[model samples]
Target: MEIILEKTTKPFFKKHAGSQALAKERIGAILEREQATGLTKVKLALRQPVAGRPCFELRCNLAKLGSVRVAFILDGQVARI
Candidate 1:
């Protein structure tokens, strides 16, 4: 699976110093769990559709930044964030 961070999301990383790394870690864990089990069996994230498009939200909490919601649409083997 490939993860593509949308262009609009770049600013968030720029504004928050460590958010990008944390997000990556969370995403990696999600993928690992999903691979070991399955998307349906993977927990720790929320599955919510946006504009009728299936989307998943991964929440990351940083000591300095609080919580950030990383929402991505899973299309086949690609994940658009």
Candidate 2:
């Protein structure tokens, strides 16, 4: 499996939550898991948008720096983050 970053909403998503790399890692984990589990495709709706389109939202728990929400898109061997 592979992931393709369509956009880096970090500059915008960071305004509210999570870091770019952190969010990407978390999402990547989930995506990888899904693929391993035989899940072909998935689309998690985020409260944000990418280029006027909906995005997949992710979350992180810093326990110190606080938490954040990441919005991205994922597809077969390619994803947008």
Best by lDDT: 1
Each prediction's TM-score against the native?
0.54, 0.43
Clashes of each: 0, 5
Q: Deviation in angstroms for 71 in model 2?
A: 7.3
Question: What's the CA error at residue 68 for candidate 1, in Å?
Answer: 2.5
lDDT of 2 by residue, 1-81 (tens): 354545455355557464555555666677677658764444567566656666665564434446555455555566665
Candidate 2 stretches with Cα past 4 Å from truth are 7-11, 16-18, 40-75
For model 1, how big is the CA root-mean-square deviation? 4.5
Candidate 1: stretches off by over 4 Å:
18-22, 40-53, 61-66
Q: What digit string (tens of lDDT, one per residue) describes model 1 on residues 1-81?
A: 677788978898898866676776666566556655666542334455655667666554555677667667766666777
Instruction: Please give the lDDT score for candidate 2.
Output: 0.57
- What is residue 57's positional error in candidate 1, in angstroms? 1.7
